[model samples]
Target chain A: MPVALEIVSPEKLLLSRPVDMVVVPAEEGDIGVLPGHAPMIVTLRGGFASLYEGGKVTTKLFIAGGFAEITPERCTVLADEAHPAAELSKAEGQRRLAAAEQAWEAVDKMDVAARDAALAALQVARAMVDAAEAP
Target chain B: MPSLKALRIRINSVRSTQKITSAMKMVAASKLRRAQVQAEAARPYAERMERMLSELAASVAGNKAAPRLLVGTGKEDTHLIVAVTADRGLCGAFNSNVGRAVRTLVQKLEREGRKVKIFCLGRKGRDFLRRDFADRIVGDVSFAGKRRIGFADAEEIAVRITSMLNEGGFDVCTLVFNRFQSVMSQVTTEAQLIPAPPPEAAAAPEAGSAMRAMYEFEPDEETILARLLPRNLAIQIYSALLESAAGEQGARMTAMDSATRNAGDMINRLTLNYNRTRQANITKELIEIISGAEAV
Candidate 1:
């Protein structure tokens, strides 16, 4: 059975397709769901989400922290900031990564919320770069 | 008689003021363009979010186990007003218009014997409400240094509001902001945040006894809704901020343009007065010299 997935961000709809499986970066860890997977709603961390379609991996998306709803038949992802890995510029990603690291080093200066936000941004930046390089 | 040096100094000052006003008008025009773009870009997201929420809320409204955020507490005794305004106040009546609308609502709510607490988003709003609703103010958030508004700021506000909700702080939450309709017209609007206004009527699916569409909830309706509700709030707040930014720029542009024209008019009138005074002075000197020569 094919699973219908709709990937959304506040700015625009990133993707809508029927795919065989989806690998989501849940808050806990990477969660891969095939058809007939258990109904679950998982909080997503900032990372790359891979979609498998028609027996081949079709696309990779970089998602900022958000939430995902996975039913037995469909998956819906609502993200704060989501973009196709191809859309992100390599230089910008690298710049964000560097900024995130600097912010992380000074994490103690920031409040708890700021630290978490910095971490999330760092994760998203790295994930985009990594996904672009991935086979 | 006034010294010529004094008149010269006055004229120079007016010229300087004219220059300043003209420069300000140009700056405001450029800022308005950028602000308009930001506001327009945010509309699609806001509209989409509303559509999604309405669609989901329609289904959830029928379910008994829907989260309290969606269903609301069903009591409106206590009210929380989130006032959105520009931190800076140069724009003519832009912040004050929103402030006035909020004031009217606050008065009306108080008259009805409802308890109203305010969470002010900008410094100008806070300043205005301080004299009247000082005791009712719970929190104040300002983006004084932030050149542009972002989701992170809205998320911070959402987190604070949600925690208050969880703690039973207020029964209803209302957002007051200036809705950007056009460059000339910005209508102030008050929106109810809690329970999300029951989704638009047209968005509700038709009532069909024969057709039953079953929705499978992931984790559970309550759980997903609990998380989604806060995100929706954040997104809405972010959208409001964007709208305010754009509205402020438009208002500033109009205000500055008018000011520049007024200054030009003032300068023209003053220059006419100065030239007339100089011409009269020359005529008086010529007449006195001729009369003295004839008498001699």
Candidate 2:
């Protein structure tokens, strides 16, 4: 049995299909899942989710951090935002990274909540740049 | 009876108004379709997020050290209402429905001796509530001329609310918006945002109980909840914004449809009167001319 993988974003479902194997960018580390993987819930990081079918990588998605719930037969990733790696632009990613840096600096140090938000935005910006260059 | 020229002008004005209302009706109809598609597209993510949260929150509902977002500050004194509406008007009562719902909720909470604050999300809501509850409105964010309302906008609003939660702005927070039911119906809904309400147990409880799997938390429950809760809040607000936009379009379509019909009726009446008056003037002119000829 193949693993049913569903990658959903705030705007829509990006992908849903059964694949031979799937690798997710978990907070702990990159984890690979097959059909019978143990049930686990992990927060995701800003990186790529590579899905393999027939011993080849069929799809690669860049996901901004959210979380995933992995059951025995299914893996559901609720992404903050997602785009096909092929669709990303290096210049756009670079611009976002620069803006994120400025935003991070502009946030008041006394405000922990804003600081956390800026850091998260920076992480996504960095990941987008990296993904764009390599994808 | 009015002169023929005056009657003609009245008919022409009513005809122009009818054209404008009918054009607006068509525009609103097309926009409503687009908004409904957008709202539909965003549903899967929202439902998945809600279900996952419900399952996770069910486990930590009674924990003493639970995140305040999940369990509140353990008080019910202050209430914050995050109400959303359209920025533009002429959507029938779509904006006012949300405004009035917030009004009633504020009054009810105040009568119970609870301190109430408003976090108005759109201009119309602020405009409606400003008459009496201006002081109660702590913040108002309006996207008056934005090309489109996107997830980033919702995230900005969600971030502010979470920051307010951290700063002890209110003990409990409730989100009020008009939920789109159909083109002709929008239900005003109030949902508790902070102190995240537990998922309803009655919904598919049997299926859940039979196949519930014991799962391991990757970074553990508390850490995951801390991250997921805020993200969930943003998703909730995003979906609400999308649905409210759809409802606004739906309301506008219905309103414009009736306005167009009313304009048609007025034009019909004016044209009938104009034709009758023109015929009457012709008859009087012919009588005067024939009488003058006979007298001559």
Candidate 3:
């Protein structure tokens, strides 16, 4: 059974396709969606989501934090930023990673909220680097 | 009498000005198309968010221990204003209208003996607000380098606002922006963002369903509300930004259209003056030559 997936941003719709399954980066952990999953709403962390098609799963995007709403018939991701993996530049990712690391190290001197934010950025940057370098 | 060279130069200058206005009009129209689409697209998400939040708020309203963000912090001594405008100006009265509305709000708030702090979203807003409320401004955000408005930009502002709130920045937060109505009119609106107001009465709970739907909160109501409140604020900011962008375009199109027409009128008037002056000169020369021949 095919599951309808839509990835939307404020400006425009990025992706709307039917796939067999999807791996979403939920706040707690990665949540996998199949055709008949129960209705659920989860906060998304900044990371990558994979969409599976017939006998092939494609790693399509890096989403920068938002939410995912999954119903039996469809799954929708409302992300802050979503770009195709192929569009991710290795140099940009590395630079961002370094910045995140510096920001994280200074997190201790920052307030609780800033520290949390720095950590989230660190996670996203690291995820991007890893995803871009993956074979 | 103006020399032929002077008349030619004047016409050339006016033509150049007309060309610039025409080009600006075209650019504004193209941008208006994209901005309108973005503004329209944001409406559904905002409506859904309001619907969902109202449902949640209605359920939580009965609870005495509701989150502070919903019922507010129970103080009105301090206020924060988030004013959104365009980074660039050319749109007639677009930025100024918003600036005027914000000024009115600020004065009213001040008269009530409340302290005001400003969070400016666009460069134009910052420039205007700083003129009067310079000391009150806590933050100023601008996407001057950005090619398009995106969630990341909104999120950055949201994060800052939420952090300030968590740190006890202000008692109330109000958003002042332009609501895109059509190509001819954009209304400036001021809305309360913090201690989120009860959803508008028109959008409130429907009467047909006297029975309330029981909702099972996944991570507990407080946790969900805590997370959702900040996100809702961000969404509101994002919506306002989109509306202002669209409104700016609409205003520019209207302004430019009038400017182009006005330029045409000026060119016509100048051309008429030039023609009459030249004809008078030719008539004077003819009369002089005829008198000289008759005298000879």
Candidate 4:
């Protein structure tokens, strides 16, 4: 049996299909899931998630921090922000990276909570750049 | 009988008013469709979040270490009422209904000797509540010029409420908004925000029940709950905003439709009166001419 993988953002559902495997970017580390995997909930960091089918990567999605709920038969990713990696252009990524860097530089002026949020945003921006440049 | 000139002017004025009402009705219908689509799209995320939070909350039901948001602050003497209404007012009693609900709630709370703080979301609610509850009014947030309601607007309100909660501004928070039932109906509702309400037993999905027993958290449960509680608050606010947006459009559509029909009826009546008056004048003139000729 294939695992049902669903990626949902606040704006809309990006993907919902039965895939052979899914690699989620958990907060601690990347976790790979196949059918019959143990049920777990993980906090997502800023990175790309790879959905596999027939031993090939079917799609890669850039996800910002959120949560992943994994059941044995299904995996649902509720991302704070998510977009298809293919939609992230290099130029756009670079622009975002610069903006994030500028914001990070001003993080010192913000409170502890705002600074932490800014750091997460910067990491997501970097991940976007990495996803855009990947072949 | 009224003069023909006066009746003709009245008919012309009524015709123009009917034209405006008909145009408003069409505009409201289109806006309602868009708002309905957006509200429907936002439901899945909000429902899923609610479900997940409820499950986690169920597990930590008796734990003392659970976040303050999930568990109450051990006091309920103070209440913060967030009344959400529309910025504009042509939608019949949509705003007034919400205002009435809030007013009733406030009166009840005050009678019970509980302190109440009113936070108005839109201008209409603020204007309505300010008349009687001016001293109780704390803050007002308006999105008057915005063409569309978005998550960002909700987030801003959530942030303000969270900050106030952190400062121990109020013991309980209640959100008052119009729940969109259909284009013809909207029911005013009050949802508790602070000391979040316990998840209902039926909220857990049957399919996820088996997996629920074996689920493990990556970090600690407390850590996840702490991070999730604020986000859940924001999600709840966002969904409420979406519902209010749809409700506003729905109410507007219904109100405009009635207004348009009423204008049509008035125009018809005015035209009929105008024709009758003109005929009376013509008949009177012919009768007078015949009378003069007969006398001669």
Q: What C-alpha lDDT does candidate 3 achieve relative to the native structure?
A: 0.80
lDDT of 2 at B244: 90
Q: Between 2 and 4, whose DockQ is larger?
A: 2
Taking the candidates in order, what DockQ does each have? 0.25, 0.87, 0.26, 0.64
DockQ-based class of model 4? medium
Q: What are the per-residue Cα lDDT tens digits for candidate 2 across B149-206?
A: 7888888898899889888999999999999998899999999998787777526667
Instruction: Report, for all candidates in order, the number of backbone clashes.
Output: 0, 0, 0, 0
Model 4, range B18-118, lDDT digits (tens) per residue? 78877888888898888888888777777777767876776677898777777767798999999989999999899999999999999999999999999
Top candidate on TM-score is 2
Q: Which ranges in model 1 have alpha carbons more than 4 Å from their true place?
A: A1-8, A11-46, A51-59, A67-77, A83-135, B1-7, B62-65, B201-214
**Candidate 2 regions off by >4 Å?**
A106-117, B201-207, B210-213
Clashing pairs in 1: none
The C-alpha lDDT values of all candidates are 0.78, 0.87, 0.80, 0.85
Candidate whose lDDT is highest: 2
Q: Report how far off residue B211 is in candidate 4 (Å).
A: 4.1
Q: Report the poorest 10 consecutive residues by lDDT, candidate 4 chain A.
A: A108-117
Alpha-carbon error at B244 in model 1, in Å? Answer: 0.5
Return the candidate ranking by TM-score, descending: 2, 4, 3, 1
